[model samples]
Target chain A: MDSLAEELIQIKREGAAAVLATVTGADENGGVEPGQKCLVRDGKIRAGSIRDWALLQAILKEAEARLKEERSKLVPFDIPGTQGKAEVFFEVLPSPPKLIVVGAGHIAVPLVKMAKILDYHVTVLDDRLQFANRERFPDADEILVGDMAETLKGISITPWTYIVLITRGHKYDEPCLREIIHGPAKYIGMIGSRRRIKACFQRFRDEEKIAEEVIQRVHAPIGLDIRTETPEEIALSILAETIKVRRGGAAQSLSGKQ
Target chain B: MDTIYDQVKEFLDKGETVAVATIVSTKGSTPREVGAKMVVTAWGEILGTIGGGCGEADVRREAIEVIRTRKPRTVRVDLLDDISSDSPAVCGGIMNVFIDPWWKEKEG
Candidate 1:
């Protein structure tokens, strides 16, 4: 691999966001040529051979907008003070989606394993060091042992983060849910029985006065109703629900009997 | 394990240039969504797929040409016309594929 390719692999491994700009077309006298490229990370040009002073400045400015939206596109740019009309394709490489599993109990063991299989940046946390150790979660990216709510408050949550609350009981899960309920997580699912979830939402709605829409966002009684019995089956259902939420799928039966 | 970049890196490590064809944008009902990619080696071997059928074949031809010239170009693939083809990939949509050549020389 070349230095650029090596850096790209490292960037992906670290799950860093970046934009790769490639000039696909340009006028001859425009001082920019096709196939010229530049790599942008953290609002600066990190690599690539696009060395034109004006073109680099233009690309840096446009790359920021592309990275902000996390959308790749074929964009046309007309450089200032030059007759350079070029079409550059900005490819946004967003960070991988993260999975934060709170309360490393029985369900969490299989949940963490499945999330890792789905290529999530899995973080398993619990109050008990015995439960939240590497012995059980060998594939977890982070094994956090601390107060569940406090740990959740300390950790950074992004739109790509998926939080699962499968604590020992409602008392443990409630505080953890409160910490991340208003945050920017993409999906927030709490494991509990329907009656327990209803009482919890009632407390949030009446006592705390949390909005109905806000409480509605929490996927309590989490997981698709596939009549899950075992921990592994429940874990699979939860992951399937998260996938449905993330990818906008209609949860129809795929029994394939038809 | 199915990362196209990893395969591209492997080909580059072997001193063989390859073309990375990416569907940058699509209109109507294409088989694959935008950002679907296929890596075409200089020997016309493909790693991933941007949807199979006549459209992919056209892109493969252009990808090899991109590798030979070591230049990047965008090929507009029209899947609207070929509805009678045997391949199930025809979805009556138009997709713009950007074929970019990758090699060791482009690096710093």
Candidate 2:
């Protein structure tokens, strides 16, 4: 499958919740492009792009304000160099310590089932209605309907939130990460081989100019050092790491008491 | 069950020193499993529920006694006997309640 499709599938399986912030407004200086979108998941930028750097800076500022107030809405912004109607849309996807699994892929299916059993408020996000249906994910708290970026727009990522990105490939992972990295999620993990992660991190650093520190926060090659090879074992490792981060414990130790 | 915040607020407003018994966990077929709560005062006033019936009534009585003595205790009520003799419930569940008392402070 295509990378975007693959990434979408992975996200669905892992239940990574995020927010989609779209730039619906531009100033006279064209601070924002008409259709620019940014995905925010796990307190980080996940995917899509805001054409205008200045506009994104401003939007990030405003988005931070809205986040503090715990409010979500369609915000309009005027272009810098022109006198036109404001046309920007910013949607906040709020996921608590709650987990939002996208895709329901082989990896995500088990993840969602396990998260629910652990008492997390879990949501499943998938563009394909068939994949996101309740029968497929009976334990899910919500089965969202829409595209990865668009569906993610409705979620809010709090400190209590944890996101696992096991998307099929670079295509879905890039945009999802671009959107999510800016929010306040506690943990953001991605499943990939060492080479894939190295390349992805390199792109973020070289092209996106995302600080190395920020990029380092991401747990790529996701999960603990359990040497898991199967989907279920991989899910267990990932969940274990997530639990460790959520409880403010080190990943090396399974028992959080110490 | 109602929200604990609301229940606590209502109990506080009535000028009652109440013993709140919360069922934090349960096993088997217990009536009102985990999170079930009951509030009882030293003067015999009761509010909320912890598997109401003779077992509940007995719990309330014990709670009032706890309040009078200012001590905390965990009481186990077996519903099987109570259901056949005094209470209306026939659930055959046992409830273990941890009774804690709350009171308003007077002026210094």
TM-score of each: 0.77, 0.51
Cα lDDT tens digits, model 2, A90-154, are: 44433336776655677888888788777778877767777778888887888886777566767
Instruction: Report the lDDT tens digits of candidate 1 across residue range A1-258.
Output: 277777777788778888888887888768777777798998888888887888788888888887666678888888667776888888888778899999888999989888988989999999999899999999999999999999898999987789989999999999999999999998888988878988999999999999988898888788887888999998998888878776666773222110
Candidate 1 reference-contact recovery: 0.48
In CAPRI terms, model 1 is classed as acceptable
Model 2: how large is the Cα RMSD against the reference? Answer: 19.9
Worst 10 residues of 1 chain B by lDDT: B1-10
- In candidate 1, how many Å is residue A196 off? 6.1
Query: Positional deviation of A28 in candidate 1, in angstroms?
Result: 4.6
Off by over 4 Å in 1: A28-30, A51-69, A81-84, A104-110, A128-146, A153-156, A181-184, A191-258
Best by DockQ: 1
Candidate 1 residues B1-108, lDDT tens each?
335677788888888999989888889989887778899999999888899988999999999999999878889999989787766988989999989888976753
Clashing pairs in 1: none
